[model samples]
Target: MSEQLPKEHVDILLAAAIAAPSMHNTQPWRFEVEGHVIDVYLDGSRTLPAEDPTGRAMRIAAGAATFNLRCAAENLGYGTWFGLAPYPEEPDLLARVVLEPTGARNDDLLDLAAQIPYRHTDRHPADATPLADDVRVALLQAAYAEGAELTWLGETEVHTLLDLVLDTDLREIHDWHRRTERSHWVGGERTADGIPSSALGPRSTSYPAAVRDMGTRPADRLRDERQFEERPELAILSTYFDDPADQVVAGAALERVLLTATRAGVSASFLNQPLEYDDLRTKVQRLTQRPGNAHMIIRFGRTRTHTGTARRPVADFLPEEQS
Candidate 1:
């Protein structure tokens, strides 16, 4: 058997993997290296039960990390092969990435890998300027290349989607348990995981904004109100199926789209409140007028804010080797 991967390379790949965004920034992923194969597992103890009852988001987040690891490995002159749920008995094992020597480098993936460290989830108000046609095409193609579909939302469709998002807000507000569960993750300090107050964009003005309001705590008085962009551009990413494997690939596609947008100097935020609920999610799908599960709803444009949440050190998520 080939010797285990070098610690230095493993660290770099793991770092890139952990940088992936998870639902509520939970960072619900763990890594274990066995020989040349590195495995990804869902940290069930960190699961957001109320927000992700079906465990869909956990799988998606894991796939996003897997995508990043692949990109990082390729950039670093190594090739990676990933098998989702490689073992039938180990359901918690989300993926397995095996590293092999490969000096070949794909310039495009390398470019995306470079942006991985710099991509920040911009919740700040975006400029109302629409993206150029070519840029939009590239982003769509990015998702397509990863085996997902991207649909640009029209003005009417955006209005419908916004209404669904509003309903989602109401639904969440009514469910105190879920709300409380999600709020626990809105941290004040700059911890390795969880969205900090600094990264939480300014509060939306009195009126409803086309973005999610993760809600600030009373003690978080420093977060002043700001007007979000009007008529922000929106898109729906979808997959033909809603199974575990489909969700995984959709996540990889979502990351590809995000990285492509970042490379184009575009910023994005998730208006995924509706996607979390079945009733509201059905309405969201209708807006797409397509056949597939709407994996994510994205609002994107330009933003001056470069706020970013921190990821836990790789050591925190990786298993220690036994002597």
Candidate 2:
């Protein structure tokens, strides 16, 4: 008889899924599976209550997990079938995926799957060298595959986007409620979820205008003033609708671009500040010359940093059956 598929296979899949970047590397999600049915849950403990008070980021994270699970199952020779939030009682359960036998594997899936571990959110200034035309095209194609579009901001447009992000940051920083909520995620040291000071680079005061400052700590003292790149490459991910499902698609696409960049020897960091504030989100939509439902901004280029950020062990988030 054929050897039984280890029940631990689902846990392996969960490990791969959480490796995807999240806002603040929050890793804001959980999973449960029985047989082939896998259920994804949002771990409230990891929620970014300051910026994403209503758990929007958690839904986006779950959406990213859904995409990763699909790719992983295909790599393992299983066709994926999924449904969204089948049980109303379990509101945090974002998705349910079922794996079915399918004897097929392709290079595209393998190429992306190979990138699962290498992808990291590099915050250090990207190399000043501009991206080649072909690299930009490839990255754009990666976004399109997941039903989203990427708009590369021109040098002339960078300042406008920066202003919107900074404005959002100022609003968050001054809000007493937001301040308390952000403090809850970080203790004296780094944990599995939330951005750690070590990962925030040496910058002090505020984060770059294009990045979200999840209120972990001011790395201003550690940042190299000259090393900060003035004209970082900026790209926006957009969908036609501004709904929960659109956020998920944008997130999955965001992960696809991130992993593709990792495989291509490019490093990326994100600035979700514009999307965090409603007015700023509208401004980004106008700036991108697209619909007003922009989900995130990603800055990418070559960077010298090589460290990967922290993540909770897969067993911690996996359901008992798989664990």
Candidate 3:
């Protein structure tokens, strides 16, 4: 049977959920709580039609939020049972989670919960130092635990992937809609949601940047320029299918790997430009030599500390009746 969680517990869970990273920090999620049941919904109004025409990125972000909700529940001595797209009639409802009182806790999830506040997308150049083998193994295990595959790319594969990214970037340069949409959420004045200029990393001095250049405006040109890593570590996170449910699973796996990297003192960022195109996405899957749809291209390494983007208060996500 479900238990009635205190308001304080609900607050912590919602806070953790909103902390999950989204593309351009859109933070496109909503919540409703009744007793011990928490419903997660995709805020359709927040969608970036130009960049995320298929809504794949939004679903992934919702999945990340769901994972965080579970972790927070476990941390508070509650076991969670959740389902993706639980209501067929309510297409916007992405997930429904029930909290059950469990005296026992998931130690692994507890450890991950502790790292939540520390995990941020690092856009600056990472140190050329490679990840330790054991660390790589842990990241793989983290993904497997969440029902996804994380494949580390080889030097040649990384180069090939970089070529695809460059092609996508060139295509985006001429796409006015995409450029405007990206700028809407990134490299602007600080806001409650979306990335601020302060967190926008320096521009890369070389082409085929390991990091996505988020500086999209003339004012952004004034930002500092730095040399990014020549051979940065890269990995691909994939799922067995391209369905909405599968995308949610991919997001959960992505967050697990991110938190694991954070606990190991590794910084991470995304190179998801290629994944936005169908052909380039297929090529990315080919790089894996594995049977799955590529969802994200993650770059992991050690880097100097950087501030995380801001998030809206939990109250903003609650429905009017609940609020």
* Best by the lDDT measure: 3
Query: How well is each residue in 239-275 modelled by candidate 1, as lDDT tens digits?
Result: 9888787888888998989999999999888988788
Worst 10 residues of 3 by lDDT: 1-10
Q: Which lDDT value does model 2 have at 181?
A: 68
Steric clash pairs (candidate 1): none
Q: Write the per-residue lDDT of candidate 2 for residues 153-270, one digit (tens) a residue.
A: 9877788887776677677666877667666664235666666655665343334455444445454334444345777889988888866666777778888888778778888888
How close is every model to the real structure, measured as TM-score? 0.95, 0.89, 0.98
Best by TM-score: 3
Q: Which pairs in model 3 have colliding backbones?
A: none
Model 3 misplaced stretches (Cα beyond 4 Å): 1-3
| Whole-model lDDT values for every prediction | 0.84, 0.74, 0.92
RMSD of each: 1.7, 2.8, 1.2
Measured with C-alpha atoms, the lDDT of residue 284 in candidate 3 is 97
lDDT of 3 at 249: 92
* Candidate scoring better on lDDT of 1 and 3: 3
User: Which scores greater on TM-score, model 1 or model 3?
Assistant: 3
